[model samples]
Target: MKIDIVSVFPEYFDVMKLSLLGKAQAKGLLEVSAHNLRDWTHDVHHSVDDTPVGGGAGMVMKPEVWSECLDQLLGLDTSAGADEPSISQGPIVIFPNPSAPLFTQADASELSGAQQLIFGCGRYEGYDARIPDYYRAQGVDVREYSIGDYVLNGGEVAVAVMLEAITRLLPGFMGNPESIVEESYTGSEPLLEYRQYTRPTSWRGLDVPAILTSGDHGKVDRFRRDEALERTSQLRPDLVERLDCSQLDKHDRAKLGALGWDLSGEHPRRTK
Candidate 1:
């Protein structure tokens, strides 16, 4: 896979170039590049932002530099359709923002299959609104994802997150594929599962669950599912609805019900 990042802070990309992603590049499985967004600037200060058109709190990234840089890198006219894949092309413009949509495991999986992925990191309040609209007109799907509820200084961190998340999902990135499938949010189960540990048999007076040491896969799976349900109901119940309980037999529901779990209704304190 080929990944391109457009950001003012190109140096921030060193993290990606030095870790697992770096190894991927070394193995010839991945090609990643970070371009300084200001390179397209023609001014002495290389100014890329200006005050808002109708008086806003912060400056907006200028569209000219972005358009020129994108055009040169993509080797296409500014009005060209971004989705037109010829002999070699990939998805471009995965922007990070507060709106747009939420990034999910499905999105990461889809990105892992792409031949090329481009990220546009904006700063100074926001980018020229027209950029996304323009890309949308060209039938290109530009994803604007928010990492969380809170906002960040810029999209650099968001880009880092997206890169790592998508990169790790690629084949051979990890030694064990089961690790991904059984991960916290990878499978249909959206909640954190019950996990037990092995130690002094007791830790701070809290002993590990007895079922974990029984060496019974059936019992352990049921215990883990029940614990997952309890934990989700207590912490992030909103996720419980998304979990795939089809794997659960009658035993699973009975265990959860015995623990005062109300899976049929929203959590007592609903946030979603």
Candidate 2:
């Protein structure tokens, strides 16, 4: 996969050169590049922001600068030439903003399969809304996402957070694909992952669950599923509410009942 980032602080991505992302790039599994948004400026100051049209506390990112940078990266030329494909044709464009919909693991999974991704990192008060609006009108798969409810100084850190989530889902990026399957918020049901332990059976007087060390694979699997259900029920009841209870068997229903789950709901009728 190829990822391009446009930000004033391109150096913020230097950390991507370390750890799994670096290895992924080294192995030809992924290609990531960060370019300075200021590079597109024609003025001496290379300014990329301007005061908002409406009276606002912060300056907004200039759309023209973003347009130029995107055009260069996407090979979109205004001059009449061979019918050149628009950059939006191949790359999914993402803009991080505090007011946008929250980013999700499911979104990362979907984007992991894309051929290319382009992130427009906004700073100050964020980009002139017209940037994404213009691209979307031109048929670009544009998405505006927020990492969480809180606000950040810029989108650079959000871009890194998103990139890490998407890249790890790419094939061969992780040592074991099963690890992905069993992780929290994955698979058909979005349950939190079960607690895990390794190495010392007894650490600081806390011993690993006996079911894990029992060598009874079936029992261990049951324990994990139950733990995941319990954790999700306690922490993310919203997720539990959306679960497809029809997928549960007699044994699963009994376990949920033990946890005080209401199985009388139309979706999960109690089995005789």
Write down the TM-score for model 2. 0.93
Largest TM-score belongs to which candidate?
Answer: 2
1-272 per-residue lDDT for model 1 (tens digits)? 88889999988988887877888888888888999998999999999999999896999999898888776655454446656523234466798997657887778877888877889999979899998787666566677888888788889999899888899988888767677775656665666667657778778989888888888999888778777778777777667656445555577557656655544543322332
Off by over 4 Å in 1: 78-88, 196-206, 243-248, 259-272
Candidate 1 global CA lDDT score = 0.77
lDDT scores in order:
0.77, 0.87
- The best candidate by lDDT is 2
Error of 2 at 212 (Å): 1.0
User: What's model 2's lDDT at 119?
Assistant: 96
